[model samples]
Target: MTPVLSRRALNRATLARQMLLERKDISVLDAVSHLVGMQAQTPHTWYLGLASRLSGFEPSQASTLLENGDLVRVVLMRGTIHLVSPSDAAGLRPLVQPILDRDLQNNTMHSKPLKGVDLARLADMGRRLLAEKALTAKQLGAELETHFPDSSPASLAYGVRNLLPLMQVPPRGLWGRSGPIAHSVLSASGSLSLDEMVLRYLAAFGPASVMDAQKWCGLTRLGEVFSRLRPDLVVFQDESGRELFDLPEAPRPSEEVPAPPRFLYDFDNVALSHADRSRVLTKEFYEQVRPRKNFAPQVVLVDGFSAAEWDVEDEVLSVRAYGKLSRADRAAVKSEAEVVLGVYGVRKVVFV
Candidate 1:
C-alpha cells in the first residue's frame, strides 16, 4: 500500500524543508541554495524571508554577496525575478527560456508591437550594449529603437529581456539601498541538467507532485522527467490520491510536530511554489486574504499554515488575522511579529 500524506503531514514536511519548523544556523548562501532560491521580486522585503528561516541572519551577509557578484537577481522560474547564485542564474535562465518565449509570443500588449521583429538580432544588440555597461530598460530600448525603428521601444526592450539572460545588478537588490532597475549580461554558466534540477527541487520543496514542480518553475512537460526518475525517487500519495515524489532521504517529520509561527515576505516561494497550496495556505484563509489587484500580502503562518496578513508602515507592524486565534496562537503570532519587526528595525506591533 502506498503511504498516504495528510494535509497536516504535508505541511510539516514543507515547513521542515523550508527551515520554518526551526531556524537553522546555516549561512545565507547555503539557505538560499537549499531552498533552490527565493522568489525575490520585491527588493528589501526578501531579507525578511531569510530572517524567518535563518538564525542570526544579517542583511549584510547577502548584500555583500550581491555587491561582489556572488548572488544575482535574475529572471528564472515563472519568468519573474529570483535571487539566486551565479551558477543557478546561468543554468535556470536557459532551462526556462521557453516560458519567456511563450510569454513574448502571447503577451497581450507587447506581442503585437514585437511582431515581425528579429529577436535574434535584438538579443545580439542587447548583449553588446550590456557588455559595454549595464543599461536600464529605458536606455537599452532607446538604443535599440535606432536600429528597429518599426518596433515600439518598450516592446523591443521587453522582447530583448525575454530573449536574453540579463541580470539586475546592484544596488537594486541590496538591503537599505536603492537604485534604478539596470540590466547586465550574466557571464556565468553551469552544467546542471534538467534531471539534477528536478532532484534539487524535490530536495527543497517536495514530497510534491509533478504539477507542483511545474507551478514552481512555470515549465510544462515535467511529468516526463518525474517519470524518468521514478525508480530512484520515493513516492507517496496525498489525501486526494495525487502522487507525490520526494528524495529518499528528505525529512518528512511527524504531522503533530509543533510548528513555530513564521513571517513570510510577499513573494516567498513557500506560499507560491505548490500547485495545491493547502499544505501551507488553507482555502478559507486564502479567500479571506486573497490578493487584491494582483498584490499578494505578506503572510503570517501559525501552525504551519497561513493565518494572517501583515504589513509594516510608519514603524508599526500591523497584523490582521483571517480568523479568531486561540489565546496561545495569538501570543505566538505576536511574539513572532516582534521578531519580524526587530529585523525591520521597527519597535511596535499591532493586531487588528
Candidate 2:
C-alpha cells in the first residue's frame, strides 16, 4: 500500500524544503539556487521573503549580488520575473520559452500588432541593439520601430521580450535604490533538461502531484516527465488519494515538528506555487485575505498555515488576523514581526 501523507505532513515537507521551518545559514546565492530562485516580480518587498528564510540576512547581501551580476531578475517560470542566479537565468529561460511563445501568439494586447512581423529579424535587431548597452523597454521599442515601421513600437518591444531571454539589470532591483525598468540580452549557455528540472522541482517543492509542478512552472504535459522519473522517485498518496512524487532522500519531516511563525512577502512563491494550496493556505484564510483588485496582501503563517495578513506603514508593522489566535500564538506572531521590523529599521508593531 502506498503511504498516505496527511496535509500536515505535506506542509512540513514543503516548509522544510523552502527553508521556512528554520532559517538556513547559507550564502544568498546558495539559498537562491537551492530554492530554485524566488518569485520576485515586486522590486523591494521580495527582500522580506529572503529575510524570513535566511539567518542574519541583510538586503545588501542580495543587492550586492544583483549589482555584480551574480544574480538577476528575469522572466522564467510562469512568465513572471524571478530573482535567480545567472546560471538559472540562462538555463531555465529556454526550457520555459514555450510559455512566452504562447503568450506572444495569444496575448490580447500585443499579438495583433505583431502579426506579419518577422520575429526572427526583430530578435536579431533586439540582440544587436542590446549588444551596445542595456536599454529600457521604451528605448528598445523606439529603436526597433525604425526598422519595423508597420508594427506598434510597444508591441515590437513586447514581442522581442517574449521572444528572447532578457535580464532586468541592476539599480532596478537593488534595495533602497530605484531606476526605470531596463533590459539586456541574457547570455545563452547551459540548459536544464526536463528530467533534471522535474527533479529540481521535487527537491524544492515536492511530495507534490504532477499538476502542482505544472502550476509552478506554467508548463504542460509534465505528467510524462513525472512518469519517466517515477522509477527513481518515492511515491505517496495525499489524503485525497492524489499521487505525489518526491525525491527519495528529500526531507519529509514528521508532522509533529514545530513550525514557527513566518511573515511571507506579498508575492512569495510558497503561497503561489502549488495547484492545491490547502497544505499552507486554507480556503477560509484565502477568503478572508483574498486579493482586492489583484492586490495580494502579504500573509502571516502560524503553525505552518496562513493565519493573518500583515503590512508596514509609517514605520509601524500592523497585523490583522483572519480569526482569533491563542495568546501564545499571538506573541509568537508579534515576536516574528518585530524581527522583520528590526531588519527594516521599523520601530513598532501593532495588532489590528
Candidate 3:
C-alpha cells in the first residue's frame, strides 16, 4: 500500500492546492476550480479569499464579474453561499441540490413559509424576475409579496433562496465592498455542465476523499459518477485508512517538503481539509475560531498547525503565534508575512 502523507507533506500539498506555493496567472474561473472554492460570507471574507489570490483582484471586480453574468452567488460547499463562476455553479448546483433541499426542509427559515406552496411556480417566477434585472433579496421579497401577499417578505426571501438557483449581481462580492446581494437565475445562466465541473473539482482538489468533496462542497456521491470513470483516475488512502483519489498527472510531493508562511482566507479549503483537521490545525487553533464581536480572525501558519490568530489593521499585519516557533520557522513566517505588507503597498508587518 502507498504510505500516508505525513503532516508536513500534507501541509505543502495543501499549500499547492491553495496556490500558496507560487502564484499562477490563471483567471478567476480556473483559480476557483483550484482549491475547489472559496469560503463565503456575504460581502466580507469571501472577497478577501479572492483578493488574497488574484493579483489585480479589486473589490469592484467581484461585483463586475457578477454584473457581467460571469459568476453566481449561491449556497454551495458546506451549505454556505459562495460567489462562483456561473459555469461551475451550473454543474455543482445539481450535485448539491438534494442536500440543499433537505436542509431547507429541516430548517425553519424556509420550511414554514414554503409549506404547502407551489414551489415550482415560485422558483420560476423568481428566476424570471432575476433574469430581467438584478434585484436585492429585499426587492425580490417585495416582488414575491405581490404574488403571495400573505407571506412575510422575510420568509419569502429565505424560501426563494432555498428554492431557486439564484446568483447575486456583481459589486456585492467585489473586494472591500459590502451591501445588498442581488439575484440572477441560474437556469438563464449559460455555464459549464455537471461532468465538466466534476472534472474541474477533481483536477484542482483531488487526491481527496469523497468526504472531502462533500465537506468542501456541501454535496456527496459525486464519486458515484466518479466511480463510473474510476479507470480514468488514480487513487490513494489517508492515514486513517479512508480511501483517497487523485489524478494520475497531479503533483504529490514527498514528505518533508519545505513550505513558507501562507496567509489563508477564512474557511478556504486549506483549513477545511480532513475530517480531523490536525494536519493543518490543532485543538488550540480551533478554539480561537470563536468570534470576537464578529471580527474575522487572521490565522497564521507555523510549521503546519494553525498556531495563532492574527490581523491586518492600521496598515500593519500582526502575527500572534499561539505557541513558540523555532527560530528558522519564525524567520520563514516573518519573511513571507512581510510581503503581505506589500499587498496594499504598505511597509509595516508587525508580529505580536
Candidate 4:
C-alpha cells in the first residue's frame, strides 16, 4: 500500500520545496531555474513572487538580469508567458511545441480561415522576418500581410505566433518600466524529452498527481512518462486514493512543521501549479482566490493555506480574511505584511 499523506503534510512539503517555508539565499537566476519558471504574463507583478521567496531580493537585480539576457520572458508551459532563464526557454519551449502547434490548428483566431495556408511557409517567413528585427504582434502581422495579402493580418500574426517560439524582448519586463511586448526568436539549443520535463516538474512541485503535472504544463498524454519514471520516484497516496509522485530524496516535512505567513502575488505558481489545490487552499476560498475576469487574486497564506485576500491601493496594503484567524496566525500575517509593504515602500498596513 502506498503511504497515505495528509493535506497538511503535502502543504509543508510544497512550501519547503518552493522556498516559501523559508527564504532561500540563492541568486535570482538560480531561483528562476529552481522553480522551473515564474508565471510572468503580468509585466511587473511577478517580481513580487521572487521577492517573497528569496532573501534580500531586489527588483533592480531581476531587472538587470532581464536587460543582460540572463533571464527571458517567453510563452511556455500552458502556452502562457513565463519569466525563465534563457536555458529553460530553450530546453522547455521545444518540448511544449505541441501546445503551440495545436493552438494554431484549433484556436478560432487562426484555424478556420487558415485552413489550407501553408504553415511551413508561414513559419519560415515569420522566422526570417524576426531574424531581421524584433517586432510586436501587431507589427509582425502587418508585415506578414505584405506577403500573404489574402489572409487577415490578425490571422497571419496569430499563425506566426503559434508556429514560432518567439521570445518577448527586454525593456518590456524590466522593473518600474514599460516597453512594447515584442518578439525575437530564441537561438538556444538543448530540447529536453517529456520524461525530463516531468522530472523537472516533480523536482520543483512534486508529490503531485499525473493530472497535476498535465495541468501545470498544458500538455496531455503524460501518463506514459510518469509510468516510466515510477520505479525511480517515491510514490504515495493522498486521502482520496490518488497516487502522487515525488523525487526519491525530496523533503516531506511533518504536518506539524512551522509555516510562516506568506503573501502570494497574483498567479503565483504554488497556487496555480497543482490541479488539486486543497493542499494550499480550502474549498470555501477556492472561488475567491482563483483567477477570474482577467484578474488574479493577491492572497495571504497562513499555515500553508490561503486565509485571506489582500491588495495594495494608495500605498496601503489591505487584507480581508475569509474567517476569523487565531491570535497567533493573525500576528504572523501582520508581521509578514509589514515586511511586504516595506519592500513595496508602502507606509501603511490595514486588515479589514
Candidate 5:
C-alpha cells in the first residue's frame, strides 16, 4: 500500500525544495535554472520572486545578467513569458511549440484572418525583420502587412510569435529601465522532451500528481509520461488517494517543520503549479485569493499556507489579511515584511 502523505507533509516538502524554508545562498543564474524559470510577464515584480528565494539577491545582479544575455525573457511553459537562462530558453521553448501552435490555430480572431496565408513566408519575414533590428509585436506586424496587406497584421504578428523563437531584448526587463517591449531572434539551441519536463517539475514542486504536472505546463495526456518515469520515481498517495510522484532522492520533511512568513509575487509557480493547491492554500483561501478567472493575488504565506494578499505602491508594502491573523502571525508577517521592504530598499510596511 502506498503511504498517505498529509497536506502539511506535502507543504513542508514543497517549501524545502522551493527554498521557502530557508533562502538559498546561490547565484541568480543557478536559481533561475533550478526553478526552471519564473513566470515573468510582469517585469520588476518577478525580480521580487527571486529575491524572496535567494539569499543576498540584488536586483542589479539580475539586471546585469539580463544585460549580458545570460538571462532572457521568452515564451516557454504555458505559452507565457518567463525569465530563464539562455540554455533553458533553448531547451524548453522547442518542447512547448505545440502549445503555441494550438493557440494560434484556435484563436477565433486570428484564425480567420490568417487563413490561406503562407505562415512559412511570414515566419521567414519575421526572422529577417528581427535580424535587422529588434521590434515590438506591433512594429513587426506592421512591416509584415506591407507584403501581405489583406491579412490581419495582428494575425501576422501572432503567427510570427508562435513560429519563431524570439527573445525580448534588454532595457525592457531591466530594473528601473523602460523601452518598447521588443523581440529579436533567439540564437540559443537545445531541446527538452515532455518526459524531461515531468522530471524537472517533480524536482521543483514534487510529491505532485499528474494533474499537478499537467496544470503547471498546460499540457495534457501526461499520464503516459508519468507511467514511463514510474520506475525512477517514488510514489505516494495524497490524503484523497490521488497518486503523487517525486524524485526518489528529493526531500520530504516532517509536517512539523517551520515555514516562515514570506511574500510571494503574483502568479508565483509555487501557488499556480499544482492542480491540487491544498499543499499551499485551503479551498476557501484559494477561492478568495483567486477570486476571478485569470486573477492571482500577490500573497503572504503564514505557516506554509497563504494567509493574506499584498500590494506595493511607491515602495510601501501593504499586506491585508484574508480574515484576520492571530497576534503572533501578524507580527511574523510584519517582521518578514520589514526585511522584504529593506531588500527592495523600501522604507515602510503597512498592514491593513
Candidate 6:
C-alpha cells in the first residue's frame, strides 16, 4: 500500500533531511552538498544560513572553508549565485551551463553588446585571465572592454560572468566579511566534474521528479541518467496526483515526525523545494510576511507552516506575525529566537 504523509509529517521529515530539526555533525562543505546548495543570492546571508544548520555552526569556520578551496560562491541552479562547496560547484556549474547560456542570450540587460561575438571565445579569454589570479569584477570589467571592444562595461561583465564558469573568489564569503565582487574561473578550483555533482543531487534529493531535480540544480538535461536510474527510485503522488520522485533509501518518515522551531534564511531551499511549494510556506503567508516580494531569513514556523517572519537589524531581532500563532506555538518561537539572538549577543527579542 502507498504511504500517506501529513503536512507536519512531511515538515518533520523535510526538517530532519534538511538538518534543520537538529544541527548536523558534518563539515560545512558536506552540509552544503547534501542540501544541494543553500539559497545564496545575497552571498553573506547564505553563509549565515549554512552556519545555522550545522552543529556548532561557527560562521568563522565556514569563512575559512570559503577562504581555502573547500567552498566556493557561484551561480548554479536557476542562474543565481550560491555559496557551494568547491566539489559541488565544480560539478554543478558545468551541468547548469545551459541555463547559464540561456540567461546570457535572454539578458535584456546585456545582449546588445554581445550580439555577434562568440561566447566560447569570451570564456576562453576569461579563463586565461582568471587562471593564475582572482580579479574583482571592476578589474575584470576594465580588461573585458579592452578585449571585447564591442561590449559595454555592464554587458562585458555580464557576458564574461556567464561565459566563464567563475566563482566569487575567497575572503568574499568570510563570516562577517562581504568583499567587493571578485572571482576566479572554474578551472582554478580543481574540483569534481559536473557528472558527479548531478549524481550527488539525485542521491541526496531524489525520488524527486525531473522538474524537482531541475528546480534544485537549475538544469534539466538528465533524461539518459534518470531513465537508467528510474527503476531504483521510489515514486509517490502529491494530493493533486502529480507524480513525485524520491530515492528508496532516502527519508520518508511517518507523517507524525516532529519538526521543531526552525529559523530559516530568506533563500532557504525548503521553502522552494517542490514545484507546488505548499509543503513549506503558503502563497498567502509569503505575501503577508515578506514586505517585499523577495526577501530572506524568514525565521518562523509553527504547526508545519510558516507562521511569521523574523529579521536581525541594528543588532536587534524583530518578528512580524503573519496569522494566528497559538500560545504554545508562540512559546516555541520565542525559545528558538532566543538561541539565535544569543548568537548576536542581543539583550532580548521584540515581537512587533
Clashing pairs in 3: 59-174, 59-175, 63-170, 63-171, 67-170, 75-81, 77-217, 78-218, 87-192
For lDDT, the strongest prediction is: 2
Task: Please report the TM-score between candidate 6 and the true structure.
Answer: 0.90
Residue pairs with backbone atoms closer than 3 Å in model 6 (clashes)? 9-255, 206-246, 207-245, 207-246, 207-247, 208-245, 208-246, 265-297, 266-296, 266-297
lDDT of each model, Cα atoms only?
Answer: 0.90, 0.91, 0.67, 0.88, 0.88, 0.70
- For residues 33-72, what per-residue lDDT tens digits would candidate 6 score against the true structure? 7877776766566654665577677677777877886777
Model 5 misplacement above 4 A: 287-293
From the highest lDDT down, the ranking of the candidates is 2, 1, 5, 4, 6, 3
Instruction: List the lowest-lDDT window of 10 residues for candidate 5.
Output: 282-291
Better of 1 and 6 by lDDT: 1
List model 4 lDDT by residue over 212-303, tens digit each.
99999999888999889989999899999999999999889999999999999988999999889888988657556455567778888998
Instruction: Name the better of 2 and 3 by lDDT.
Output: 2
lDDT of 4: 0.88
Q: Can you give the lDDT of residue 212 in candidate 5?
A: 95
lDDT of 3 by residue, 105-184 (tens): 89876678777777788777887777789788889889888988767777777777867777665566655555576776
lDDT of model 5 at residue 178?
67
Weakest 10 consecutive residues of candidate 1 by summed lDDT = 284-293
What are the models' TM-scores? Answer: 0.98, 0.98, 0.85, 0.96, 0.96, 0.90
- lDDT string, candidate 1, 148-235, tens digits: 9999999988998999988899999898898999999899988677888899999889999999999999999999999899999999
Model 6 segments beyond 4 Å from truth?
Answer: 1-6, 188-199, 221-225, 289-291
Give the distance in Å from residue 317's predicted Cα in candidate 2 to where it truly belongs: 0.7
Question: What tens digits encode model 5's per-residue C-alpha lDDT throughout 1-352?
Answer: 8989999999999999888999999999988888999999887888888878988888899999999999999988889899998888999887788898899899898999999999889999999999999999899989999999999888898899889888899898898786788999899877778898889889899989999998888888999999999999999999999999999999999999889998899878899889998899866575573567877688889999988888878888888888778999988888888776565666777888
